[model samples]
Target: MAYAIRPFRKHDAAALADLTLAAIRSLGAERYSDEQVAAWASRHGTADRFVVRAATGDAIFVASDADDRPVAYALVGMRGKEVGHVDMLYCHPDHARKGLADELLAQVEHHCRAHKVTRLFTEASELARGPFERAGYTVTHRRDFAIPHEGREVAIHNYAMEKPLT
Candidate 1:
């Protein structure tokens, strides 16, 4: 099936939140407990924040859909000094392994190139590392953080990955 990719709209926030939460929850039974997932989802799933971020020209939110409903989305931000950051990249669990993330990354890279960005960076979870690596990102560091969920802290380890854009 063909996917439609475009800039995020204010009305798309609710859909984006759902997609984000779904991606997080799909990490599996052991990666994160239900309590942790629920907590993180509560904060990150806010449609208002997505709208505000999209309104900021510095950030770009792109969504890919089949049949006019979003199945994947990515948020990219241009940092200072020719640097770009992938704030988030999520695909519905059902859509995983179907090249949607790759397409979204390609779009972000194209945006970076058009704007003269020299480097792109992302903090990728273990589950996401392989795809980023295949797309040419190299891990520069590994860090552990406590992600707050349901009034408790859930430890999550992720890699700081970077790739040259130019």
Candidate 2:
């Protein structure tokens, strides 16, 4: 299906949050245990989080369905005007593998270029590593961390990837 890539809107926050949870629960299960996936998904449980991130100067793009609802999104946090970190990239499971993410990333790269950003990076989950690599990002290292879940720390890992925007 063809999806439209556009700048994020305030009303899309809740849908984006839902998309994040669904994507993580479904796709993350392939690479992470149930507990780890749950832990990761919890961090995105609030729509206000996206609002705060955008208010803090992050650039966010959304891929919308025909009805103009968000099915995917990409958020980039700029660092000192020369670097950007892809803080989040999520697509609803129903829309997976449809090139929506690639389109959003391309839009992000275009935004970064206009702002003179020379580097873009992300800590990509296993499910996202291949897509990021295919998007021309190189894996710099593996990031291992733990998140609090049900009173314990759940272990998780992801790849640190970067691409030169120059």
State which candidate has the highest TM-score: 2
C-alpha positional error of residue 80 in candidate 2 after TM-score superposition, expressed in Å: 4.2
Candidate 1 ranges beyond 4 A from true positions: 28-30, 33-36, 59-61, 79-83
Could you tell me which 10 consecutive residues in candidate 2 have the lowest summed lDDT? 78-87
Tens digit of per-residue lDDT, candidate 2, span 70-160: 9999999965542589989999999998888788888888999998888999999998887788889999999999999889999999999
> What is the per-residue lDDT of model 1 for residues 15-115, given as tens digits with 9 covering 90 to 100?
88887888887753336667656655665777787787666655554556566777888787765542588878888887878887787888888888998
- Best of the candidates, lDDT: 2
Q: How does residue 109 of candidate 2 score in lDDT? A: 89
lDDT of each: 0.77, 0.89
Q: lDDT of candidate 1? A: 0.77
